[model samples]
Target: MSDATKLLAEKRTEFGKGAARKIRRAGNIPAVMYGHGTAPVHISLPGHDTFQALKHTNALLTIVIDGDEQLALAKDVQRDPIKPVIEHVDLVVVRKGEKVTVDVSVHLEGEAAPETLVTLDHNTLQLEALATNIPDNVVVSVEGLQAGTQILAGAVQLPEGSTLVTDPEALVVNVTQAISEEALEAELAEAEAEAGIEHEVAGEEAGEAAAGEAAAEGEPAEGASESSES
Candidate 1:
């Protein structure tokens, strides 16, 4: 996986929100690289290049800082939820043989048995793998599986040299018979009623507390007035 992604880098000369906005206006995204017991280094990367690279999850980066090259992984990326703009990215430096923990999405490859609904209980699995050799996604087959069947985390085969960091007994895929509409509605109503009852009880307790405080102050003033009259 030695596909080197080239990015035009620029040094961030200023700090704070104003500086970040200025960087974005110049078609660049502010990024900070930190890891391996080093102070965070702030920099700017070409907006288009950063966006394109991040489109691939677990993107490997060859960052050039002041003519020095470093291998990094995109640890975090902030983006506009509805737009194509990049905000800020957090990168972690990595060595060739270093192992890192990451989460990979679970992908179902085959269909379940007839009339059995395949439910994905876990969408992703945690894995500890070499930095440069991370798997894109974990694929699991449910071909011809019947109802009441389950696939555990450990049962899903991982790529060679990759170790599972998630709990072995964690349920990944579950095949269950579909519930009827009546049962679903009944459960929903019961949950809502339980929540409403709890809220009402809390409100009553708060009201009682306020009333008690008011009564205490009123009694103190009444006692003072009676003593003055006497």
Candidate 2:
């Protein structure tokens, strides 16, 4: 929703893998513009600028599309599995006053009751809000909450003009009693025992392989020595 999310776009005439590769070589990102009952338009954007703008979740982009100014929201981004380079991006056209449904991160604030552990069941929740006024994040309080306490989706407060799209009864945060040191040690011991068993199995397999090789060599040498003596 910031002016920093503006994108300078260039219409892409070329298609296929070769064109996309060429675009990447030129330090640009291949992106698609769709949605709002419009045709999919292929475009290229500056790589570094696009990456910075996309740091925001559900970022509202002021795009210069085909010499016309249009507002859009980042719908999806495809990135390389092993590399940090982005592969493609999907943008959805939107109006300033339009209410769009998006997921916003829920951050925990304050500490729970002593000796209790706070577990977040949902990190983000879906909500409908204005395109130009999307909330950055929602904060949930865990102040002095005891074990077995759960916060539902509907119980969280929303920013102005925002409505929850997720199920109201869905659990968002759960506070539970912390595990004892003995329990943790017991779990670790079990894991170590399992690993030791696997190590022993591998050692036995290696020993068997060595024995087979030694027998194979001895048999050949014995036959050769007998023939030479005769």
Candidate 3:
């Protein structure tokens, strides 16, 4: 968790897409803070500073508005789909020691046993932790796990004071035998067959089978004619 970063904010009066565009043009992100049964506050935050501070998940921020500071957590951040800019932010007022549920990322470390493929069933786990003590991520060690090994959510060790909100029986990782290229292709072929998809090889084979089936009927084969012409 990163230390709270302070940012000076300005209250936004004008509302609409046009106003939001103007705010972004001035290098500020339009944001709304709501929580604790209080009225929502519409404000504008410094674009660069806000983006930097929000790099951490569940980022804690000290939002200073009109010389008054409020503690907030970056609950949701909207961004341009194609750009690296934050379009808007949703802040939830949080007090110290308050518990909040969030989805924390799962990071895998160490390698599994040889000739085994490690599949991460869950990339993140739902966790309930203190607002000010939210962990950045949960780490899982695969180490020397062998094939057919499975790791469940309950088996994962979470950070201190963090409670897992995800179902304990949920599968987190599965280790399986590594497949050869030929085996993978065969599996794909079987799946495509089930889906009624045909391979180009089947069509090509019917069209070019020895290119000479007509010869048995006393007619020049297409391949023979083409070869002769060539």
Evaluate model 3: give its TM-score. Answer: 0.81
On the 0 to 100 scale, the lDDT of residue 130 in model 2 is: 91
Which residue pairs clash in candidate 2?
none
Instruction: Please rank every candidate by TM-score, starting with the best.
Output: 3, 2, 1
**TM-scores of the models, in the order given:** 0.76, 0.79, 0.81
lDDT of 2 by residue, 1-230 (tens): 45537788999999899999999999999999988898999999889988888877988888897678888988999988998788899988998789999999999999999989998999999999998889999999999999999999999998878999999999999999998999998998899898884434586676677667767887542223344665
In candidate 3, the residue pairs with backbone N, CA or C atoms under 3 Å apart (3 or more residues apart, or in different chains) clash, namely none
lDDT tens readout by residue for model 3, 1-230: 76678999999999999999999999999999999999999999999999899888878899999889899998889989999999999999998878999999999999999889999999999999988888999999999999999999999999999999999999999999999999999999999999999755685676566555775676665545444545
In model 1, what lDDT does residue 219 have? 50
How far in Å is the alpha carbon of 4 misplaced in model 2? Answer: 5.8
Which parts of model 1 have CA positions greater than 4 angstroms off?
179-230
Q: Tens digit of lDDT per residue, candidate 1, span 1-230?
A: 44758676777779999999999999999999999999899999998888988888787898998888888999988998998898999999999889999898999988887777898999999999998888888999999898999999989999887999999999999999777789888998899898884434586676677667767887542222344655
Q: Which number leads on lDDT?
A: 3
Better of 1 and 3 by TM-score: 3
> Model 2 scores what on Cα lDDT?
0.88
Stretches of model 2 off by over 4 angstroms after superposition: 183-230
- Go through the candidates in order and give the C-alpha RMSD of each one to the true structure: 13.6, 10.0, 4.4
lDDT of 1 at 30: 98
